[model samples]
Structures are given as structure tokens and as C-alpha cells.
Target: MTENLDPREGSLTTRPTAADRARALLDPARCRGLVPHDAGYLQTAGIEIPATRGFGQQLMRTRFYAGVYQLGRPIGLRVASALQAPGRDEDRARTARSLRLRPGHTVLDIACGPGNFTGTYGHAVGRDGLAIGLDASHPMLRRAVADNPGPAVAYLSGDAENLPFRDGVADAVSCLAALYLINEPFRAIEEMARVLVPGGRIVLLTSLAPGGRRDRPHVMVMERLSTMRMFGRDEITDFLRALGFDEIEQVTAGLAQTVTATKR
Candidate 1:
């Protein structure tokens, strides 16, 4: 059954005590979706998240997670961007334009670290909407719950490649700057397409190989260090086309690319 969790269409909410939010989230039998700290988000009856995560995410924990993410993310992006398109904070603008969310829309943010974008999605969707953020890291989810609390937003600890939601559950799907971290990115994209309603749009940001070259020394070195999948230009674009997506638009900033398309 679809849950209506959002209390309003507003800015980020302050962190409340576990007992405060538990009244709305905890169902005695299912306990499926609750606050991240108290119930660890979606710990339902049959769910098991036995999947791999990126080395950086695996290395982060509650102690220093927030600091690292808030401080380090931009630096990393800047360095990566320096290698290719060399633009400033284009991710936020590109995504905001592509999503074009209306009230009550459900947006699934795959690999949503810290639920940052997820909460924004919730605000965009307004009172009768849902924004589900799925990530395989426990620390990330916990931090997210602390930082980005909302009635409309829910965080789940799960694999991006193996989502738990039913088909056509979301109006829009997004995988930002993290698709390359998944062990099976193509499978993850397929699952994203499956869960989205036809005509629903998708926004993706991932690393593209320089001149589609992974055989280069520097690229190989970085790949060995981070275990990030470097995609070719046509790789994801072609895959989306085959998956029956249209109106494909790609915006490149440095080594990363943002792709927006509608599911046919």
C-alpha cells in the first residue's frame, strides 16, 4: 500500500526525538518505514541488503560521515570536473530542470547519500508526495535521517541494483553521481526504468571515460583505487534508448555527465 508521509511542502525539518516521529512511522507488525536512527528505515519482513558498496561509502561511518561528505564532496567533484568539461555547480541546476516535479509525485533517488536530494524532492512534491532514498550504507542513511528529516521523505538501506519497490511506483527516478559505484550499473538502470511509470522522467549523473578510454594509465589507476565503473559516452545513452526512453538530453560537466530522458 502507498503511504502518505509528507506533512507539508516546506523547507527541511529539524531533527526530532525518536519517540516524536515513531508515532507516525512505526507500525507494530511491519515496522517497514520509520526514522533512520530508531528503526533504520525500511527493515521489513523479507528485505535483505546483501550487496556491495563503493569504497568511499564503505569507509564512512557516523563519527565523521557528515563532516566528510559536506566538505569533501565538492572537492572531489571539482577535481573530477577539472579533467573534462570544467564547469561549476551544474549538477543541481541540470537535475532541477530535468525533474520538473509536480505536486504529489513520487521520486526515487537511487544511491542517495545522506538523503540530501531526497528531502529536496519531498519539498518539491509537496504534502501528498513521497521521496524514497535508497543506499546500501548504514552510516549514510543514519546521517541522512539526522540531517534531512521529513514526513514525506523515507530513507532505505538497500542495494541500488536490487530495489524493493513495485513496478511503476515512482513518477521520476534519479541516480546522481553514484551509478558508477554500483557493481552492476546496467541492472540498476533497468530496475530504475521498471519502477518508473511510463512517461516518467529520469535524471542520471555518472562518470564518462575520457574519450571513452579506460585503457589509459591515469584512468586505470583511478579505477583500481576507487572501483568506479567508467562508462563510455554511448554506453548509458544507448542503453536508455533501448529501454524505450526518448527526448534524451545530455549535459556534460568535466568528467561527469547528466542525462535526462522520458520513459516511453
Candidate 2:
């Protein structure tokens, strides 16, 4: 049986309490259509039952991020856009310049939320190049397609850990903000490496909570709700190196880190 809770019903004030939001995060029915669900064995007859792992366990293996995107899509989109708005253009330009994307290079953007990086990449690659945006959420992909329309841009539904493309099809690849949310982040990185042509660049932007510091309340809440652990600089670098990537360069920007590496 699925439990449905509306985000608007409980609190007296317009805003929901932290507890309310947290409770909503635990609802299994919220993720029913978006991901698969598995029912575990019953502990005792009419006494206790084991909770199904569902898609949350299958992908992120966390209660916080199990149905996060599907549940928070509207607010999440706004938050993502607003946060990136301040440095959106400049960041995109810097990444494009750093990667040296030309008119004919194909770029793959993993977890390309709401077409932020996808639109910029599409523009950077120009008419001759292709910018493919892959994301697991259908609503996000719909918004991405609606917001970024061009012959050079395409959107697909896929998980980062298991990318849908063939080997060595892209000249460059990028994943932003959503890496830590993945359960097998290294597998996702391997997929990124797999999809890139030899010598192709891979750019990543993700949180850096060194020593697992939870200084910011919002960041802390997100991490708690999503059950995601941030990766340190060395951990990411080691993964890239082990995957045969070279010339790794990492730079910190506020709480986030940007890494650029070349597949060797």
C-alpha cells in the first residue's frame, strides 16, 4: 500500500515545517511511478513489516533522495536555476574555454537539470556540434526540451551509473550538481569516461564537504534528506586516475568543486 501526503495540508503557516518536509521524504508512494519498488519479507503477522527498498534503494539507497526529484521538481528547478543564475554565464564560458570545445565537437551532459548546462553547451558547440542532455526525470527532461530547443540539442532519459550511449561517442562530457546523489558515483564516472572519445574532456561540478562538515543548514538538510555524502577532492581525483583519466585539475568555488580531466 502507498501513502500519499500533500505538501500543503499540515502546517498552519504557509511554509511547511522541517519535520513535515522530512516526513514527506519518507513516503514510498511518492516514487512509485518514477522507480521500481521491492517488498521485503513481513516481520510478523499484523505486527510489523519490512519496508520495501523501492527505487531509492536501487539507485541511491537512501530515504532522503529516493523520490526527491519527482517530489521536489517544481521547487528544485527554481532553486537550481536561482543558485546558478549569478554565475551561470561566466561558469559556462569558463568550462567551454577550458575544454576548448570547437564547432564540430559533440558533448554529453549527464544529469543536465532543467537544461541549464545543456543550453549553454548547445550554444558553445554551435550548429555543427551536438549537445546531448541525459537525465532520469521525465519532468526535468520535458522542461529541458521545452526550454532549450535547437537542432543541435537533444534530451534523453537515462541514469548516470548506466548511460545509454555507446563507447567513445562524445568529444566531451559534463555532469553538474547531481553526482553526489548517485549511489555508485564511480560507476557514473566510468560511464562518463566510457562515452567520451579518447583525449576527450570530462567536466564535473559537485559539492565538497571535506570531513563531512554540515555547516550550512540548507546543505545539511539536503544531504540529510537525500542521504548523499559529499566527496572530497582526493577521492574524486583517485577515481578519475583509476579510470585512466589524466591531467586532472580541481578548483574550488564556494562549497562546490569543479574538476576537469582528460580520458587517456
Candidate 3:
């Protein structure tokens, strides 16, 4: 069941400094109990959960609207992590295993909800590497920002379809469990393609119907209820290829699929 946590301060985007981020992560009241107070969820210093449009949303507008209207202290994100612990963890592990991340690489995590993979990226990139997380939800970003370890981590409030960074700036880009929420998935892929330097990598992990499309009954039911749009593996790969991504491969997990692509 979803729990409601209220925010004690202004929106997360308001005055996002290291001090604010630190407080939000360490001080439970600052983020309104958004981080779960558990060993598995809370022990990880670099993990943060971004605010999502609840579970199984269908419409992008509704998801965005839900993000905008949901008031009060945001629920601790670690709660979801504790409940759905490793929901899509296998896919993430698989993607992480395949990627060739090195020290000092500049990594960008689009839609880095709750800092799950963000934590993984932090581990992979090491202290020298820089990880930038981008998400549209303030609560989510706030929680993620709060959770991430300092120095190598930074969270930005922006849409995946419209990233606010210089072109060819990232050495690698990864999006975990967030692309399906985008209204224009193709456009977002284009943006991802545009942001990476030559030979930069992209990893996309998303949940959808069992097939390679977005029309599974169970998933459809969830989407209708949640008002969110989910995409399929084939569609995601094709979109990436069309956007000039090469060496695209799809890997399946418990309920979601992960796609890895390298920029040509």
C-alpha cells in the first residue's frame, strides 16, 4: 500500500545546495520521510528515490499532474525500496555487468528514481567519476539528491525529453525504470543520443507487458489505473537504432526489460 509523507519545506528545486541535499538525506523531516529507514534501503548513502506518479499510472499528463499536485511532505522513497526491494534489480545488475564503466567517466542517469542504479553508477565510477541524475519530479529528485554521496553526485530537475546539458558531455548515460513514463519516448531517445560523446553508452531499463510491446493485459491494467505509458523492448531498440545507436541488445528480467546501446 502507498503511504503519504508530507514535505516540511518548499519544493526540492528551491535552493538546491549541498547543505540542503545533505539535510534532506540525513534529516528525515527535511524530505518528509521520503527515505525508508531500513538497513537495505537506508544504509546505502548514494541511493535516493524520486517522486513518481504512484504505481501503474497511464497518462503522462496525469503522472505529471500527480507529481505537481501531490502536496505536503513527500513520502520517504526508501519505503518503496523496502517494499519492492529488487523489483527490477536483476535487469539492473545485468545492465551494470555488461557496461564498461571506468574511473573518471562522466555518467548521466536520466530518471534516476530513488538512486537505485545511481548508487550502482557511483560505485562503478568511483570517487573520480561524476554522476549526474536528472528527473522531472521534484520529490523524487529531492530524495535522490538527498541520498547520493557528495562530491561525485548531482541531481537536476529536468525532463528526460529535454535535458539541460551540453551536447556530447556525458561519457555514459543510463535510465532506470523511468523511460516508460515519458510522453515522447522517441524524442527522449533522441535527446539521449544527442547528449553522449562519440562511443558513449546508453542503458535503458523499463517495465512493460511481457511481450516486446506496450499492450500486455496486466501492464495495460496497471497503466490504465496509474495513467502512465509503458514501452516495449522492440520499440525501445528500434527507436534507439533510428536515433543512431548501434550494438543494441535487449535483456529480460522478472517483469521489466533492459536495453543497452552504444552510440556510433
The per-model lDDT (C-alpha) reads: 0.72, 0.63, 0.60
Q: Which segments of candidate 2 are over 4 A away from where they belong?
A: 1-86, 211-226
Query: Candidate 1 versus the native: TM-score?
Result: 0.79
Q: On residues 96-189, what C-alpha lDDT tens digit does candidate 1 reach at each position? A: 5588887878888898887767777877777567777877777777777777767677777767776766677688999987888777889999
| Model 1 residue-pair collision total | 3
Could you tell which candidate, 2 or 3, scores higher by TM-score? Answer: 2
Candidate rank order under lDDT: 1, 2, 3
Q: What TM-score would candidate 2 get against the native?
A: 0.64
Name the runs in model 1 displaced over 4 angstroms: 1-40, 60-63, 83-94, 215-218
By TM-score, is 1 or 3 better? 1
RMSD of each: 6.1, 16.1, 12.9
Q: What is the TM-score of each candidate against the true structure?
A: 0.79, 0.64, 0.63
Candidate with more favorable, higher lDDT: 1 or 2:
1
How do these models rank on TM-score, best leading? 1, 2, 3
lDDT tens digits, residue span 147-186, model 2: 6655566665556776645677788999877777666778
